[model samples]
Target: MRMSEKRAKMVMSQFKFLFFVLNTTGLYVSHESRDASLGFMVQRIRQMKFVGSVALLAFGHRLTASGFTTSPHLSPCSQIQRQFGHSITNPTRFEASVTQRSLSTKPLEFPENPSPFSTIKNGILTLHHRLRNEEVLQWRALAFSFFSSLFLFRHAIDVKLASLWTFLTTSSSLIPRIFRTDSYEWVLAVSAFFFYIHFFWYADVSVRKASEQGKVHPWRKYRLQDRFEADKHRRSVELKLRRNGEIPSQNELVKNYSEVTKQTGWNWKAWTCEVWVYVVPLLTWDILSPRRHRRLAAFGAPTTIQVLRDITCGLLLYDILFFTGHILMHKIPLIYRTIHAKHHQEPEVRAGDVVRLSMVEEVLEVGFSIIALNLLGAHPISRSIYNLIITFLLTELHCGFDFPWTPQNVVPFGLATGSRRHHFHHRNGKHYYQKFFFHVDRLFGFFQKDDGSLHGDSVKPNPHIPPAWQ
Candidate 1:
């Protein structure tokens, strides 16, 4: 039963009990005959009261029209006898003034128009109600608050991430000339490996320490008092001046952490068996294979043609490996947590921290570049550019700024370009993975835009099912 109906029934039941008490106390006479006993009158009152109570509670509007009247006479015996023509010559009436007074004094009073404050307050009470009733207001607030933060952060991170491009664009140019000699090929290969290893370690450390707590872990509280004091002042000022927005809840942060752990774990495992055991050895074989057949049929060899070719192949292979690995990572829910999800731990990854990923993430990063170079037969320079671009793009998208890429740059390129797009993925991680090339994702129809905006949009809340990681 609906709550209102149940409440009405309970009220009616209580009214019937009160009627029985009143009937017994007020109507009892000295008579003890079967025709007119106190018990009989009490029972009659109960029957009439039940009818009156149900009429009032169940169909109160109809009862009000009927004057809440069950009969004309005070007792049913007198009313029934009169109706049957067995007359009580001068019957006692249920005093009209007393009855009217009792009827007029109802317990409940319903207003035609509710108080304005309560109308406003109740309208904002439920998530469903807020979304449905005050949609524009909610949306405007969301966009105004969050989109501003998302864009600025995205731009800053992208600019900082541009530094990695220097390595790719500069070093790849040297590989073309050096690959001609066997000694140079080995040197470049070994050098590239070591460089990647150093970067991997550095990134791992940085990522692991990305948290605010992690930053202050090594020092004593007293030693870090100066930093804390400075942060406190800055925070106080920000809180005073900052615009209000929906603060990310603890649940949201935990969700991001869980996503990152999944990504990192899978990436680590894949790199271990996939890279060292399989990929590296395969590339080495390709390099060694060319040595046995030095005499090409007719083509003239460039200075570092062999070395460049090998490096290019390695780079292309890296891309394929990582891209495929990413696809595989999402295929099985169990593997997703330890491998591909860890990169999403930070809701707003800084540009300086782009390379700061788990060891597994590093491996995926290298593998992605390798595939682009190896399989596509791209030059070492091109491969390097691709790697640099990937790094910057990843950081920029993850930075969580709405205007991160700017107007011209905002052409959606999967999850790697738009901050608004990727931020949604980070916020809700069950979907929105393995989407970097915007056209590709668009072709596949994989986009999921945020519903709420700070200015003029409404957010329809999805079923509040947390992501698989959470």
Candidate 2:
């Protein structure tokens, strides 16, 4: 009797342990299956073609098995004795028919071989990746650098060095016959002649800035944030004034514009002014020089011819250098940030602000003009015409006006240029540096889109101000 009782107790303990194992295993397997099913649902939702869908389903099955095996409760043959000791079924076996069926079914369909057009798609993707690389832009930089340098070297004639000597030696025979005449045509002609020689350097700034950096310096961000805040405060103040029946006048408008224009100060003026200062003495020295006879004979002509020649030659030099510099300025950072940044202070530039630039900036501009003139040494006459065309273009750019100019109906083109482009540079000195042409900026993905509105949507045209005050 005692031995039988001990045997029964041991048997009972074994059964309890088996039951615990089975319950644990079942819970674990169920949890795992649920997790795997969630994963499969996610994969199906993505609908990643046929192959990807199949792969995801396979992954789900593997993960479910892993989760089941890792669980302590999901053991096989647990609690079998208690569950079926007295009443055993025909066969005690566990088979996952549902899981097998789901795994076997195809959720996505695809052709064994993709269509022939697939080859074209693959080729396009390959080309796109290749074109996106930085190496592709290197040639652009090199081309810009070469052209800008060429223009700068050609047109850098130091005319100011002899102006003073020419004046003091008015009594000298070296003075041209044109100087004695009070003719307006002759004066206009002379002004036109030397205009290129004198202003070629001025127009070269755009090129030099462009070649140095594809975009403006990053300091532009700070400036922009500041502008936004300042504008906000100004508007608030203006609103308060209007509430008090106060109206802002023309002086107030000018003051507001002045503040906006102060982004870059006239640092270029310092250098240009110095150039002129020393140029006067140099001109005087040249005039008094004993070699004045030969020098005048070589370079001196009617003031009109000289003006025309200068204008034409100056622009030829300017155009090549300007375009090249504009391209490179966006490419090279050090050049753009430090050297080209000074001009960005003026968010809204005016005509007068064009010449009032820093010397460093001016030199870069002038350098390109000189290089361009050298390359176009075909003839003074041809060079002058080219230079004048380019000069007008540059002046138009510098003037901060975007007058609506529609092209011929057949062409259906409009003038895409604007001071707003330059204004943005001044607003944020670092982001949109490329000017004259938006090619480099657009290419590098730095170009800012214009909304054809001032200060973007920030400031609105308030027609009520005048009426409110009255």
Candidate 3:
């Protein structure tokens, strides 16, 4: 009887364990399926909303036109009389003139049988017609590219979700398996790939778009004096060289120091090197880091304190590292000439020109920031947000257009280094090396004021400096 009781107990325990396993598995599958269904529903709802809005707008326009056509055409005096329910026996000259003017200005004519669907159909046709235009098509392509890049970065959200799921499932383990499935890894890899492609491709597209639209940089006029100063300096150097009986090379003497007005397009070789040397290493490090998962878990839905901590830590660390790297790149002549100067090739900076850095410069500037943030144990979501903030700032700085409504204009302090300041840096590389904030530049006396003038002692121009160095 004792043996039988022990056997029954063991059997019962085994059944309980089996049931637990089965229940957990079912829950996981159900949760995943539910999430997928929700995403599909959300997408469908957005499409419906867009269609409904378009339809409503078309209907509203049609109704407005019909209302105007059908409304009673009353003279100014008659309208007053009707409102008061009294007839005017005789009108003064002014009243008669006003009545005649009102009568002559007839309401627009409309079709007797106006089709409500006509406006909708016409709107659709007009959309199609616009899409058919080459310029419109190019704009659409650029917009698609920009949004696609953003969408790629959005996979980071998925990675966060996966990390959360993994943490929940494997909480007992010492190191959680955030990327348990092959799909998760692939998503990250693809995200990295798209990021590099976007960095390389989008700048050129943006430049082309800007050119087509005839949208000049808001601060471009400020650059006129700088250009004149540069030109004057160049002429003085050439004349001095000639007076010394040292003939400068024809190429050197006739060098164009003006900011580039046209798109320089892509440097395929540099881009390929950037992908292999910088992007690959960064992505690999990301894949290998378990801390990424921890960050995601901690920051997924942070409290107010956590939010502040992450932002503060991320900004300070990134700024210190990036500013240091930037200054070094400028101070080191060989690095500036061979590496940093690649970025300065386009003196006339555009939205797409932000990522146009040499492999080494890119690694030092962007890579260091990311690595330092990760090392600081920032939440994965915070790191992602930091990257986004950096991207927006850099893009806007290089974008040339300083719209009054931009964050830099609104904030006007802290990390909101205005586009004009950055443009000054691009125009004169000897000044403004700070990335996130202006204090570093101010501290180092390299700060360029809003008026495109340097704050500190001006550096003498080197005649031998390469054109790209500017």
Candidate 4:
């Protein structure tokens, strides 16, 4: 039963006892059979309590209803029966006035009809009530961003903007001939990986240190802070072992040491591993790939309009193609062993894992993204620009921070798959294989969490499910 009903029953019992005392004192009943008479009166009150909604009136109570008056003796009062019933207020706080009329019975007296505050509040409430549709708000954000992008693109193309063009032209003259072609994009892509990953390493490690000292994060609410995830996991596991009084095996000790080594913002050994692994394949692709020849021949200084359009298309194409390749790499056991499994080596996807793929995997990513742009007849400058954008995206997707203003959160319609999703893939190795957009993941129903929640803009509440290493 509801709490209010329980409370009402308790109050009713008290009233029954009170009436029995009055009967014992010979105030309402004088006959020797007063107990029997009191029992019947109490039974009638209980019946009315459960069966109907009506005001309760007993001896000497002021009731203003028609054909009801105060009774002086124990008798069958016909007028005490129910007339047109009205709802009774539930007992709250055991207030004495609960069964009696309120002292304040006057209507609200106002001096004005269209009061300034009342008009303003009603107008605001009407708007809030009308805008309760989630789909409408999503569409509104998307529409506003689309029109704003179009205006900027058109303005950039129409205006020459000599200062910006001069700066670029002057810089190109100083650059080497190799970079004048498509090598600049390769350099740009690599540079973006380094800059972003390094920053996250600092942000994450600083926050962790602050927490150890029982200090508030200096500026945590402004920016996303998770960066050194491998170290974070190591610390968490080490803390559990000490707190639970467990003995550690030799293998567990070594694993914790390895995580400690990764705590550095800069790891020369791992950095060396990634660079050589990427460069060997990169040199081979540049020297021999058939697509490079085609890209060099069609290369030009693309207009601002063309560059922006290709960047947009490249992001979409990359998402779909990457989604397919990523899914296949996980589903096919042989492929996972030979290629993609290397990227999953870390307990958590962190700053360093941005380029942690094996040679073949790296080559495929560079190939699909650059070659796809070439197929669209994008100029080398446009391709170079797109490379820079996608590099930042790839780094941040696994950077392990889901800050509100990040590109993942900025995108409308729950599309971008931020660091949180990739973190989930590390834990389960079963779902959320896509990198950027939710389109492919949604179609396959792989967008749901392990517990089966659909993807949304919010971070999945528990990103750190137990690791396989544990």
Candidate 3, 1-470: lDDT as tens digits:
12243453454355346434533443333333334434443333334434443443343344344442222675322332343222122212222333344433432221233346987898989877876774434455565676566456655655565566557445765334434332243244335434644653554454445535665433332232233344555667688899999987777665754444444454455445544665577557666763444434454443334434676677767777887877887889987898788888876565556667766776666566657776777654455455555556665666655444444444423345666667667767767676657677777677644442232212211112224323
Could you tell me the lDDT of residue 172 within candidate 1? 51
**Candidate 4, RMSD to the unseen true structure:** 16.4
lDDT digits (tens) for residues 57-142 of candidate 4 = 44212232222333444221222332212213341211222223334332221133355798999998876765565434454566
The CA-based lDDT of model 3 is what?
Answer: 0.52
Runs off by more than 4 Å, candidate 4: 1-153, 156-158, 161-172, 175-182, 218-270, 280-301, 449-458, 461-470
**Residue 61 of candidate 1: its Cα lDDT?**
44
List the candidate numbers ranked by TM-score, top first. Answer: 4, 3, 2, 1
| Alpha-carbon deviation at 222 in model 1, angstroms | 36
Q: Give the TM-score of candidate 1.
A: 0.31
lDDT of 2 by residue, 1-470 (tens): 12243453465455456544543443334334544444443233223223332443343344444442223663222333234433223211211322333454422222234456998898988866754663323444454575566455434432432453256335445333333322322233324434533353343344235325544322222222224434554566666778889995544432331122122333355334644642454356545653424433444322333444655555544544565665466568887676555555455554444554455666666566646655643333334354445444544444443322200011112122334455455555543444344445555665554563335532111111211111
User: What TM-score, over all chains together, does every model reach?
Assistant: 0.31, 0.34, 0.43, 0.55
- Candidate 2 versus the native: TM-score? 0.34
What shift in Å separates residue 59 of candidate 3 from its native position after superposition? 68
Model 2 residue runs over 4 Å out of place are: 1-320, 323-338, 386-389, 404-418, 430-435, 450-470
Lowest summed lDDT across 10 adjacent residues in model 1 is found at 454-463
* Candidates arranged by lDDT, highest first: 4, 3, 2, 1
- What is the C-alpha local distance difference test score of candidate 4? 0.57
